[model samples]
Target: MAIDLAPISLPATADAEQFKDFGREILGVNPGGMSEEQMKEVHDLLHKYSVLLFRDVDVTPEQQYNLTKSFDPSSENHGHGNDFSKTPGRKLFELNAIPGVPQVKLIGNGTVYNHEGLSEAVLKHPSHTTFHKTHVSAEDTAKGITRFQRWHMDAALYDLNPPRVTTLYAKVVPQGPHQTVRYDDGTGDELEVPLAATAFVSGKTMFDILSSENKSVAVRGRVKYSPHPYAWMATAHALSTGLGIVSEGLEMPDDELPLWDEDKIKVYPMTWKNPVTGELHFQVHPCGVRELFVDPLPAVASREGALYPDGAHLTNLMYKMQRPAIAPSLVYPLDWRENDLILFHNRGLLHSVVGELKKDQIRAFHQCNLAASDEPAGPTPEDVRKYA
Candidate 1:
């Protein structure tokens, strides 16, 4: 049997270093009107790249949702029954949508044209408010927490099974250099950085660069994460202590956020196999990990050494493991353009939005996420016996 894929042209600006023969920037095809054959080509290409950039394309919220389904049938996934709107009736999350479209959320920032009615309500959303131009207080930095300036996988905080694909479309973007974005190292060391770009780190490269020992740690080991509440309040409550949840989301009267029980914290294998490509990808969500534990837990202490203490050793190990993943060679900072649509494999990449928006900036992006395909992340009993 032969597979006849649709004819899709990859733009010359698709570039070399970032693509590495995997990613493709399709500026030629009209994804909104792509046939099933072309859609399959896009799907297969996405597995190879783990990231796909579609620039200057005009796709509506509904059209975007339909296009995503062309790749992953599960993109239209419904109700996992965990609350806080998983699928939102199987629709795209329109940050600017008002009056409530059935599946889309109106996360607008209240500055857009004709958005006066929703400005007040949308401004109340945490992502719009509480953003900072620089690190908060010296005390906050010393404690090892700032806003969501670090890299993270989407939905790793709340979803027991996080999404496989995360899509974002730029409806409105803040233009020009901002007056305030800065970097502070907590020791009075600061550097100025431009605002308004999103950066992506390749987990595949992260996995490939590991040493044999760290590679074992990358694949076989386990990493824990803060509970849902702390993960929820990360923007306001990202703590160095790795404990406690203190943010407005918890105190607010709205039911938009979920109140998580500590007993249900997130934990996953350090690496996982992408079901589509069968390629092993480094799986630890860098920002949210509680600690990088050696293979299994203290329950199996009989086989371990006394000198290998927990605490800061594991924390330091987590940082060492993630450092190479953030290097300039592996990280690509996207220059956002108007109507740019990006499809990223949430399982294989770590992404962070750079810069802070002033009160008047119109920088809202539409997000459409596919539901999870695999089990709750981690090593299987087979993995434990083979690697642990």
Candidate 2:
């Protein structure tokens, strides 16, 4: 016998009006204990919509891990690896393990005491100030202005395959007035978002909005990520908007990284095909990518105006291609609530942590993502022929 779950709904906020093709809210499913049938539907929904939110649900750390793992049953490693003790300079993620369920991490800001074998853990949330080259001043921050910390997918970009999905369960949501997110990239773009919201943009939309010439570039391109990406970027500063790193030659040399194997280094397609939708999503993690390789246009395709690529143009090209999808009109800033669990397709969307939290405001969430058993599928031969 199979279980029938309630149908998924669309987000009701006015902000959702801007995005007609993304986000779905699952009404009556407790992800922790879904039946096989229910899980299949959940999986399909996540791929089709890119993001699925389950509000007001109680889930233990172990249950969260189970739910995330169900997306790819063969996967067991955490998206960024379960152990960080060996990597001394990993500043990308501050993962505090839940005592028993080390797979699900407790991430947030402020002090958490005696909750999960962490007697007194003072969590420091990843902030744009620390990572970005230019950030809003303290005085401007006081006026409710903030910046997106970093825009990326939830992949380790290394030995492990990229996770298929990521689950974030909000335990404590701090409340404050909405802040303005300033791009500060000379575009003067800004978005008013809730404090500490996670902003997402559809990768499918990213590909769809591209000009034909750019689309040809996308399907034909591949991104080679740095080995031990987090360690390599430890000393690098990101662009003002956290879109990618500024190429100041400040990256840690390969010799300085954690003895990485050349075989373990990942080079993925610039566009990943959604397993369920068969849609090509422009899914590059600009921050981690070290090189871009573009295949020449197919025989019948017109190369009269196609852009030639090279090693020197990696960051700028990626930024230009991806920046449009994150405009205020396309972004979905998730205003989190306590007990709200969000499961997003890690391969189909790009997300960022927006706004800042004061010291006294305690925000705790359990995040789990399993490194997938395989790499993402890129554009097929047919796809390339059609686009290029």
**45-150 per-residue lDDT for model 2 (tens digits):** 8898888888899998889999998999999878877785654356776888788777788899999888757788778778898888777999999999999899
Predictions in order: lDDT = 0.53, 0.85
TM-scores of all predicted structures: 0.68, 0.94
Clash pairs, model 1 backbone:
95-107, 95-108, 224-290
* Candidate 1 lDDT tens digits, 1-388: 2233222232232334544744557657776787777777777777777777787888766776677555456544421222334422122122333233222333434355443234443332132123332335655433332333545676544445667776678777767562222233232322222346666767777777777556545555667765543323434433221112223343222254356555656667777666676666776665455455664323433334322323222653665666556543454656678877878877887776554454676666666664565543554555434333
Model 2 residue runs over 4 Å out of place are 1-18, 309-316
- The alpha-carbon lDDT assigned to residue 182 of candidate 1 equals 26
Give me the displacement of residue 35 in model 2, in angstroms: 1.1
Q: How many clashes does each candidate structure show, in the order listed?
A: 3, 0
Highest-TM-score candidate: 2
